[model samples]
Target: MTYEVLARKWRPGNFQDLVGQEHVVRALVNALDSDRIHHAFLFTGTRGVGKTTIARILSKALNCEQGVSSKPCGTCSACTEIDEGRFLDLIEVDAASRTKVDDTRELLDNVQYAPSRGRYKVYLIDEVHMLSGHSFNALLKTLEEPPPHVKFLLATTDPQKLPVTVLSRCLQFSLKRLSREQISGQLKTILESEKIKSDAGSIDAIARAADGSMRDGLSLLDQAISFGAGELLVNDVTDMLGTIDPQGVDNMLDALQDQNADTLMAAVASLVQIGGDYSQIIDALLLRLHEIALAQTDKKLVSDSAGNMDKLLKFADEMPAADVQLYYQIALHGKRDLPLAPDPRTGLEMMALRLLTFQPVAESKPVTNQSVPKTEPAAVSNKQPASTSTSQQPAPAVTASAVTNTASEASPAAAIAPETSKNITQNITMDSPWTDIVNALQISPLVKQLCSNAAMQKDSTFDVSLVLDQSHGQLLNKDRELELKKAMESLWGKTIKLKIELGKPSNDTPAATKKKELDSKQHAAETAINKDENIQALQESFGATIKPGSVRSRV
Candidate 1:
């Protein structure tokens, strides 16, 4: 006996056997049970999404020997012949092969005649979009009005190419691509029924590689079983699919979190030995990063079926959420750039290096006066002898005022200075301006933006009150608030109790102050430009006029 491929062997025979098309199945079942079926039916979706299969099943339902009902008796001659693809009344046409006007007219010529054996003559046209304009024109009239015993079933991967006249005459039911979970569930069921030795990890890898297509998933499963010598193994499937092992991805991520470049390179070398596809490798890494990011938002959101929830949660706790997002973006771009690189290996290596080079330095222990570096400023003249008199000039001492000013100059929020560094180090009282505290804390831009739009006040020694502006209410969330609270507590060297409320700020927010400072600087720059002697000369000699909004502050 010749072997049949899994895709063909496991084709759905009825509505109940079909998976991940509940909407289409429900409508068709309703129509059949109520005996209100339409003359023409059109099905549209991507490849491998059950467009042709549903058409075949509907054909069976309409022509079943038991009667015209949704539930067809498979043992009946009409159902058995339909399932065997030998039903005389079921005329299956591949529009792609015969797309001429003559072919369409010839097929429709017999539509007025009654079905020979079954109750109805079912016309199942696959890839109907391939029909030419003349063919569609020929099909329009018969498809719109056929004999009492005729039913038209048209299926296409591209419905947009179908003529509006033909489309308007049919009751279209679009089939959706199956989700990963849906596809995986179906695969598990098939494996159990087949008694195939398989594991969850291998099934998941195949399902993910399927990319929301049931036919593709079944085809891949067939290949995987053959590759594994009649058994499904994770290593064999990963190798067959050219996807990296989940453990390998985890190792690379662990090395990255540790900032161990050597370990990361070693992990890559192991992957090279396995001969995995670089593009798929990057995709796997990106998927892990996405999971880590989601886990950071909420640990419970991560799926446990992959047997890596603990690893993901640990990564979420150790690696900063910002780094996860950054790495994901870099990997995504790197995947796109892989094909243009000199070679796949070089592209992946350079991308890994870029990730390492740009990763932000881990936060250091709280900066103390003792840890601050003291050194001489740049010499005025390089022409002088090596040590003629540079050493004789004592370096200026670093002061708290200088530190405060230097810190304030680093960020726009630092424009509102309230206390010296020495005072803040010794004691951070409620009287200290929120801007000053915010400027000193190390946090992500999202948390910083949240702080910039809120007014902070002290309710007790360790209690803080925040009034967030109503305009930026969307920024108020638990994760960001927790991150901001942690940064502030670290800077103050004490645990803080925070209470947030949505309303108008009693004082100007840091964002408002920054805007004001920016406007003042813009006015100063414009005034200076207007008063410049060279500018005046140019205006007088050449009638040159400064364009509005062109002047920008350098300071």
Candidate 2:
């Protein structure tokens, strides 16, 4: 005799044999036991989830020779015929093939008649959603008021396609997909019963590959059994599914944690050489990273530690939370873009490089007592100098002392001096309030570059106009303006106004000119520090960089 496949051979013979669908089973069993059966029943779910099987079992239960009972004795001729799809009273129709209005009319015409040889005449219409609108309309009246001996069982994967009017006429039961553990347990029972030699690890691989479908798992198991001839092995199953071992995934992750590019790429190449699916490898990596993140926050959240939990925990400890989050984001994005790449290997490499580029570096130590060289200001006239032709041009006459005079005058004991001008640029001074405010903002290189070309104008209600040089006017961005305004308010203890206009500078005190000179130099220094590699290294190594407003000097 030809052998029956495991899926059909082990098909659930009774409701008790059904797995992961307790709610549907319980409702149907209770209805059968209490004689509270509905005329029409709808079973909805994905493929391989037992929707049609439940329909068949219900047909047997309703037509059993002993009468409609939940546990029909399989020994009875009526139950046997129903189970074998030979019962004269039971009709199984695939709506996909017979979806015409004429076919539906003919079927319903028979529904009006009483059962010939059983308690009830059952119509099990599978994929009922395929029926055309006209066909559905033709059967609506008969389905709503079918004869007492007729039962309608409709099954469909896509229930949303079914009309609401039709759905309202029947009792619907949605079947759920089985979980990995549930599938694994069921596979173990089947293998043991069949006396097939297999390992739990091999069964797990099949279960995961099945993705919550029992039929899929059994079909996969059948392939593995045939491939192995007599026994199923983990290695054989892994190769059959084109999936990498969990250990290979863990190894790849370890390489990532260590930032060992060579090792990671080698592991990927090894999987490719063995004909493993690169996409699945990436999926497994993502899942493992999630486990690592969980292990970081709570050790107990780590699942199936076995021997790899230690490595995962170590990775969690060594990496910062922000870095981990960044890695996860990069990996997800890479997965999305992987298909567009020429090859999976190249895609995986690009993803690894992205993570490496963003990893945080160790902080550096701070440099102290660094001094900047000072220059003497050339004499100036009341008229604008040639140097002032460009707004960003330096004022040869003004000195650093002139710019900081107000700040020093306001608080004599404030330690305000030329040496501390860098910090003073971050604050406003009482001396020449308007000029000093601009000088203080010059502490920021970006602001100084933009404002150097700005000549102070008369203050309006909310708008203080500055004569802007065309070249430098474009330098001011929204962020820089906001920062300047915030610093000015901190100095004045109230809101100061601002407006930009085109004009020339007013001949004021040489002190004001001197203040502008000092402000320019301080601003230049700040810009240099921002682009300085040495400063960045110091910041990363020792974490000792000055705050935005804090003073730093060359000693």
Give all candidate RMSDs, comma-separated.
Answer: 21.5, 22.8
Give the per-residue lDDT digits (tens) of candidate 1, residues 327-370.
Answer: 78667867888887779997786566445534322211122222
Q: What is the lDDT of residue 93 in candidate 1?
A: 97
Evaluated at residue 381, the lDDT of candidate 2 is: 34
Q: Which one wins on TM-score?
A: 1
Mark the regions of model 1 whose C-alpha exceeds 4 Å error after superposition.
298-310, 336-343, 360-555
Q: Count the backbone clashes (under 3 Å) in each candidate.
A: 0, 22
Model 2 C-alpha lDDT per residue in residues 102-218, reported as the tens digit of each score:
998888888877888889999999999999999888767877777888899999999999999899999999999987777888888999999999976688789888987889999
**Whole-model lDDT per candidate:** 0.77, 0.70
Q: Native-vs-model 2 lDDT?
A: 0.70
Please give each candidate's TM-score: 0.63, 0.60
- Sliding window of 10 residues with minimal summed lDDT for model 2: 363-372
- State in Å the error of residue 28, model 2: 1.3
